[model samples]
Each structure stands twice: as C-alpha cells, then as structure tokens.
Target: MRKVLNVIALLLLIMVPLLTACGGTSTDSGTSSPGNDSGTDSSGSDSGTKKHKIGILAPAVTHGWVAAVAYNAEARAKELSNDIDYQIQTSSNAEEMTSQLDDLMTWGAEAIVAFPQWEGMEVPIQKALDAGIKVVNFDIVIDAKGVYRVSGDNEDMGIQGAKYIVDKIGKEGNVVMLEVPTSGSVSELRKKGFVDTMKEIAPDMKIETYATKFTREDGLKDFADILTSTPKIDAVYSMDDETSIGVLQAIDEAGRTDIKVVTGGGGMQEYFKMMPENENIWIESALYSPAMVKDAVDVALKLLNGESVEEVKVIPTTIVDRDNYKDFLDDNSPY
Candidate 1:
C-alpha cells in the first residue's frame, strides 16, 4: 500500500509540471496577453511602447511660422510613431476645424493635441474633453476650464521688450504698440505685460497703440503711414516677426533712423539673421519656437499613460539679440 501511494504522489508531481509546461499563467512581468507585450503596436508587434492614439490639429500654413508649427508637429509625430497612432489635420477656418474635430473622434483618438488658431472653438474643445479625450491646447489658450494649455511666454515677450527699450532709450521716450487683434489671449497677455511693466518702470512714458494684422504687408503699409504721421518715435513694439519684417521694410523705405529700438516675437530665422547686420536700430525678439509643440505630444502621451501633467505648461521666453541669435539659429529650418 505504501509503495502504491508513493508511485501515485510521484505521478501527480510529474502531471503538475506537464500542465504548467503546456499552458499556464506566466511568471514573466508586464505583458498584455500571449502576443501583445508591454509595447505592442497596432499590429500587435512588440516595440517597447504602449499603443495610443493622438490627434494633432493646426491651422493651415498661412505664414512661415504657421508652416513651421505644422512641420514640427508632423516631425515629432513620426518620431513617436512606435508609441503613438497619430493623425494630423490642418484647417483654414473654424468651420473646417469643427468638422475635423468630429472626424478625429470617429477615428478613436484617445487624446488630441490642438493648436486652435481660430476662435469659437471652446465648444468643440470642451466636447472632446467631455468625451474622455485629453486635449492639450497649444499656441493659443482656449477659455475652457479643464483643458491643458501649452504656449510661450507672451507676457515675458512684452516684459523683456519693455525692459530692453527702457534701458536702450531711457524711461521717457514714446513707444509704439503694434497689436494684432486676432491673436486673442496671446495678444492680450503680451499687451498687458508690456503695459504693466512699462508702467512700473516708465510712468511718464506715453504709448500710442495701433491695431495691426500679423502680416508683413500690413506692417509695411500701416507703419509707413505711422512714421509719416507720428514725429519723434523712439521705439516700436511689434509683437510678431512677420509684422516686424514689414515694419523693418517700412522703416528702411522711409530711411528713418530716429527709431532706436524695434522689438518682435516669434522665433523666425529670417528675423534672427537681420539682427546682427542691422546695428543702426536695436532689433530684438522674444523667442517663441513652434518646435515647442513637441511638448504637447509628450504631455498627451503622459496623460494617456495615467501620468500627472501640469494644467498650464507655460514655456518661458528667451530674449534674443544679435549676440545670442546664433544659439537659436537653424539654417535648414523652415521658420
């Protein structure tokens, strides 16, 4: 009886081993299923990155900076292909963007990285957030309560411009404010920072503001009119690179040397190149790279992975001048 019991026990041990060998729960850590690993692509292939769907929305390239925004977003998406199933859509108007927003939802986009250049998008953006999609608003800050915002230091652009102008021409000079009305919150913040900072530093200074579009033609035309009408203009705060280009042209055409300082924003390669050569007028720009859109992609992925992300990712501005423009220069860059 004892020998028979011993034989049965040995047989049971051998059967258990065989059962585990055939098909059993693996002791291996971090696997989705038998085929799908931790980093499984849409094809269920191992690539060391968890699959996620991210959507990119941008305005049609109306200008060089917008073109760069689109380009950088695409480049970054391809760079993160192993981890992301990305769809990028560009729109020329708000209506087109509304339709594209719905299309993205239909495509099962779990996350969206949007640069809503046009206004009245608060509804669609909120709808996306309500649908359990994580929206990372880039470039322009929407008025939605919970959506994440990623943008440059527009206010600092104003602040830096103020400080530099004050230091260059003393606190008592007349300053021109070239404002883009369509810039929405970006323009508002920058205008506020400029006004507030200048008030703090130069209370006696007078600021003459004129509405302008973010185009070189407008800058050239409007500022040429401005130079003729307004006498003794010490500085001009043109908050856009394209517009500054036009303003510079206007100044050059008029051959005005009294304008001591011209301040602009948007990290344009062309404008940076103009900085060193033009020593007659102090030209400076507050750095705001369209390449910073890559951070929105990273933020979306982090949120999809259940990682914590900041509510407002305010990218700081770098004050660029002739001495430091070389650091930000990219010869092959589209912008």
Candidate 2:
C-alpha cells in the first residue's frame, strides 16, 4: 500500500509540472496608451522609439516658392518614413488651415510642423499646446506664445538687402520700399533689418515705405503709382521676386532711368533670368528658399525623440547675384 501511494504522488507531481509549462496565463495585459501610440512626449517623456506620428502643414502652392515648400516637406517626410507615420496638408488661407488643424488633432498626431503662411492661427496653435501636442511653426512666424519656430534669416535678408542697396546706390539715395502686408514678420523682420541697418549706415537716405502684395498684379499697380508719385527714385528695396518683376515693369513703362539698384528677396527663377539681362539695374536677391521647411520637420523630430531643440531656429541668408545666381538655378524646381 505504501509503494502504491508513493507511485501516485510521483505521477501527480510530474503531471502538474507539464500542465503549467504547456499552457499558462499571465495577470498583466502589457503597456498601452488609449488612442495614441506615439503620444505623451511634449513634457519630455521618453518614447520607446517605435513608429511615431508627425503632421506637416503648409500653404497650398500660392506661388512657385510655396509649391517648393510643400514639395520639400514631402521629400523630408519620405526620408524619415522608417521612423514616422506622417500626414502633410496644405491650405490656401487661414480659415482652411484652422479647419485642417482640427482634423490633425482628431487624427492623434504626435507632433506637428506647420508653415502658417497666413495670420489667424493663434487660437489653433495654442489649443494644440494645451492638449500636450508638440507644435512647431515654420517660415511665417506666428504670434502664438509657446510654439517653436524655424525660418530663414528673414532679418539678415533685410540686413543684406539694406547693405547691398546702400553700397550700390551710395550712402544717401532715395530708396523706395515695397512691403507685403500679409507676410507678417516675414515683411516686418526684413523691413526692420533694413531700417535698423540703414539707421547705422545711411541715416540721411530718403526712404519711403509703400503697401503692396506679393502677387505681380499688385506689384505692377502699387509700384506704378509709386513711380508716378515719387520722382528721382534712386533705388528700390523690393522685398519679393514677384513684386520686383512688377516694379521693373512699372519702371520700364514709365521710362524711369534714375533707379540704379533694384533689390529683391526670396529666390525666384524668373528674377534670376532677368539679373543678367538687366545690366543697367543692379538686380540682386537675398536667398530665402522654401526648402527651409525641411529644418522645421527635423526640429519636430528632435522634440518627439526626447532630444533638446531650440524654440527658434534661424537659417542664415545668402545673397544671390548675377555672378552667383547660376548656383541657385534649378530649372526643374518650381521655386
């Protein structure tokens, strides 16, 4: 009886071990975030380095330069495809952009890189911050308090334009200014740089600021009146390529020969072509390419991946002239 009992006990022990090893259940369900897999890094929380969600926003191709912005952003997103789940959206105006921002929030975007080309994004950008989603504004600087910004050296572009215009036309000459109202600080920073630089370099120069749009049509109309009203216009610090083209047309139509140096900003192919042709007019442009949007995306990634990033990232400006314009020429590129 004792031997039989011993055999039964041994069999019971062996069977229990087999059952536990073959089929077992755990009490834990594993870690999970309710809706977002890539969420919760705005406060510098660590991400496990899996597939993250990134949202890219830009203005619809309003012009050649804007088209390049959207294109280069897509290219950069593709370049980081392995690590991120990205959605890029473009808008024609501020209202449309705000609606698009709502859509992005609903889609559970981990981080957003936006080119707020127009004004009136203050609310949406702030809401994004309140929700703990990382926000980075590109190009056109927004007035939103906490959002990060990445843009070309808009101020330096102005500084360079101011210096170039002063150098070519002499310290004291009548310089006409063409300003874009919708461009926000893009126009403001460039204007500020020029104004401040002029104060130091050429305080006595007769300067006049006129309102204009970025479109060639406005440039033509606004500058035509400018030419008519302001006689003896020695130089023009036109802040855009499209604007410069119109200004040139107005100058030619009016048969004005007094203006020697005509300055432009934002590299444009059409304007570059004119540089060599217009030997009489010292045609120059400060390089502010749309491809700088790529830097905004890069900074967003840095923030998402628990890496430190600056609140403002400024890309330095390069002056493009007839002598060096060929280097910036890309016939296939829209901008």
Candidate 3:
C-alpha cells in the first residue's frame, strides 16, 4: 500500500509541473503584457504624442492681395500637418471676426493668427490675450496688447517710394500723393515715411495729397479728375498696385505725357507685367507681397512650441521696377 501511494504522489508532482508550464486556465486579464510595456492605454494608443492646435483668422477675400493672404496661410498650415492641427476662419467685418475669435478660443486653440483689416478689433483681441491665447497679427496693425506682429515695412515702403520718385522725376517735380484713408495706419505710416523722406531729400518737391480707395475703379475716376486739374504732374505716389493700374489707364485715356513716374505698393503680378510693358513711365511698386502672412503662421507655431520669437517681425521692402520685374513674377500667385 505504501509503495503504491509513493508512485501516485510522484505522478501528481510531475503533472502539476507540466500544467503550470502550459499556463492552464491562468490568464492575466487585468495585467499588461510585455508588448504593451511602453505604457499604451486600453485603446492601444500612446499618450505621449500630442499635436498643437493653431487658428488662422483672415478677412473675406475682397482683393487679390487679401485672397493671397488666405491662400498662403492655408498652404502653410497643410505643410505642417504632421505637427499641428489648424482651423482657418474668414470674416467680413470686425464684429464677425470677434465672433470667429470666440469660436477659436472655444475650440481650445493654443495660438491664433489674425489679419484684421477693420477697426473695433482691439477689445476682442485683448480678450483673447486675457484668455492665455497667443495672438499673431498679420499685415494690418491693431492696438491690442501681448500680440506679436508680422508685416512688410509699411513706413519703409513710403521711404523707398519717395526715393524712387525723386530718382526718376527729379527733386523739384510735382508728385500726386494718393492716400487711402480707409487703410488707416497702413496709409498713415506709408504717407508719413514718404513725406518725411521727401522733406529731408527733396523739400521743394510739390506733393498734391488726395484721398482714394485701393481699387482700380477709384484710381481711374479720381486720377482722371486729378489729371484734368493738374496739367504738369511729374509723378503719382500711389499707395497700391490696383490703384496704380487704374491710374495708368486714366493716364492713357487722358493722353497725359507729363507724368514721368507712377509709384505703387503691394506686389501684384499684373502690375509687374505693366512695369515692363510701359517704357515711357517708370512704373514702380514697393514689393509688399501678401505671402508675408505665412510668416505670421510660422510665428504662431513657434510660440506654441515654446520657442523665443520677436514681438514684431517686419519683412524688408523690395523695390520692383521694369529693370527687375521678371524676378518678382510668380505665375502661381493669386496676387
């Protein structure tokens, strides 16, 4: 009986060792496996990777330049898809833009890039800053605190325009300064730069200041009247490319050969073509490309990445004329 019991006990020990090795009905249901040692959650996704959220706010496309600002900003956002998720909102007025700002804030956007053209944006933009959202201003300047700005040198555009006009038409020529009051500080800064520079360089240069919108229609109608009134105008310090295009047309219709130069701003493809085609007049535009909005987008990303950036970034103005218009031409450009 004792020998039989010993054999049974030996068999039981061997069977138990084999069952334990095969993991018999012993499942680790609540514990993690070796494959999931990297701390993956129940959904099998790692929690360490997180993308930044960026918001872009621009005005409704009223002009080619405005359209390009939106286009370039979206293009850049797509290019950084791996690193960020973005939302772009286009508003027609300050009130609409304020609403859009609220929407972006609700969306939990880490940073916002704003291209505000209208007034009354200060209060709402300040509200955004108070919410701990980083705001990046593009093109148009606003009165909001803690906002970073990225724009072309507006005042330097005026300085370059004055220099170009004086160089082409001489120091003592008559210049028609077309100012767009609707453009606010853009017109103000450009005008200030031109006037200040002209005063320092060509004090005797007769400047006829007039207000006009930044449109071909306004340029044609307003310049036609100015051409009729001022018979001996040597140049026109037009503040926009669209305005300059119309001014050229008005000059052609009126058959004015007295005007020697037409200065413009905002780099337009059509205007660049006009520079080479018009041989008689020195057609010049201080190159303020709307693509600068891309820089504003970049600044927003930099801020979100905890990178140090300037409070204000101003892209230097490039003077384009018949001599170098081809170099500035972009067939894909909307403006």
Candidate 4:
C-alpha cells in the first residue's frame, strides 16, 4: 500500500509541471506572459493607434520664399511627429512633381499637402482626389476640385500696395507696375486688386504695367531699363520683396531722386532692413509670409482626422512699412 501511495505522489509531481507549462502558454495567448516576449498584451496597444501618414509636395528651393515654404512645412511636421508620419518632396517642374505624387500614393499616404506652382498638375491632382487622398494647396492656386487651400490674401496685398502708394505719392504720379505673368492667379488677383483700386481712388494716376520675373536679378535689370525709358516716376508697385530689392538697387545705382515710394509683397528680412535705412522711399511690404505653409499642413491633418474644413482659407495680409518693419522682423527667418 505504501509503494502504491509513493507512485501516486510521483505521478502528481510530474503532472503538476506539465500543467504549469500549459497554463503559461494559455496566458501568452490571452495576455502578456513569459512566452509573449513582445512585452505587450494579446490585444496590442497600437491596435487602434496607427499614426496618420502625410505627404508634402513643394517646389524646390528656387527662391527664399520657396525655401521657407519647405522649411516651415518640415517644422510643422516635426512638431506633430508623434501623431503623424510624413514625407516631403520638392520638384522643379510638373513632370517631376507628378512622379513624386505617384511615389507618395504607392507609399500609402493618407493626405498630401501640395504646392503645385507649375501648370499641368490639375489632372494629377484630380486623380489624387479621386483616389480619396486629401490634398491641401499652399499659395499658388490650381483648378483641382475638392482640394483645400491655405494662402495669404494675395489680392489684398495688391489693394494695400495701391492704397500705400496712393497715400504716400498722392493720387497723381507715374507708377511703374512690375507684374509677374508666370505666377498666374497670384499675379492676376494682385494686379486686379491694385488696378481696380487705383482706378477707383486715383483714376488720374498714370500707371504703366511691365512683365518681370520674381527675382532680384530680374528686378534690378528690368527696373534699370524702365528707369532709362520712363522718366519722372513717383512710385513703383512691385509684387514681390525680392523683386523690390532689385528695384531699390537699380534706383540707388541710377541715383534717381524722383521715385518716392515702392510697394512690395512677401515678408523678406533683407527687404525690411532697407525700410528704415532709406528714409526717403516709403519702402512698404504687404506681408505674404512663407510661414503660412504651416497652416496648409494643419489643414491636411484636420481633413485626415475627419474634421470639417473650408475649401479655401485666405489669411489676411498685414502691411509693414518703416514704422512697423522692426516689429515684424525675425532674425531666424530664412526669407
């Protein structure tokens, strides 16, 4: 009887070890256990917490404003790193941008913030919309349907430029208007605002429109030629800060004393520095900041999270001149 009892006890010990091993395996299947080396429950912490994937499409750094657009976009992305995963692509032209768009789509991007400055992007952008990927446009306007846009008040910049010029140089003066034709809607809206406002307030104001690109090199070269042909100019309406910088240099080099006021757009630091230095010329800039791209990124995220957003969000323009230029100055600003 004693031998049989000892045998039963030995059997119970062996079965206890096997049962304990089976229990551990069952625990791993249900929750965290020694076999579950991942240190998470069977119901993962990341089950419903997948990060949103966002893609940014911008123009390559052709200008300081363009560079700042990319810079601000990256800054905003970093700020929201935990909430999102992002990819930014810059291109010189439409074809390159289209290829980048395809890459982003292939990567399973949930939303794309596009700055399609070049033409022929409408078809590709529309395709992205059809695929159910949200697109948010920055600055330059395109004809893509259902795409959100975030931009400074471009037309108001022209209106403010007109108002500033009229106030400083008076209603009667020869104004050389530098218009950037390649900018498409941006130029048209700004020109329309300036022209319409000028006609309404100062119909007698003699305005001459000329084509120029948005570069200091173009501004200097074009304005130098404009100075030679057109005499007795009172004010110059320049649609960009870089262009105005060139225009200012041409005026200084030519020793022209007739020009009293110069209006500019886009918040540029170097251009703002010139405002206080040149006491004679009322160097004014209507603030169309590259920082506005941050808002575009925000719009993209908002749409991804199923939040309501406006089709177009136009940020109001802030007119900065010699008096207020110092207030708007940022040493960290790339543009």
Score every model by TM-score.
0.86, 0.83, 0.85, 0.87
Evaluate all candidate structures by whole-model CA lDDT and list the values in order. Answer: 0.87, 0.85, 0.89, 0.89
Rank order (by TM-score, best first) = 4, 1, 3, 2
Scored by Cα lDDT, where does model 1 land? Answer: 0.87
Candidate 4 wrong stretches, greater than 4 Å: 1-48
The Cα error of candidate 2 at residue 279, in Å, is: 0.9
Where does model 1 exceed 4 Å of error?
Answer: 1-50
Model 3 over residues 70-120: C-alpha lDDT tens digits? Answer: 999999987866567788999999899999999988888889999988888
Give the clashing pairs for model 1. Answer: 39-49
lDDT of 1 by residue, 224-275 (tens): 9999999889999999989999999999999988998999899899999999
TM-score of 1: 0.86
lDDT score, residue 74, model 3? 92
Once fitted onto the true fold, the runs of candidate 2 whose alpha carbons sit more than 4 angstroms away are 1-49
Give me the candidate number with maximum TM-score: 4
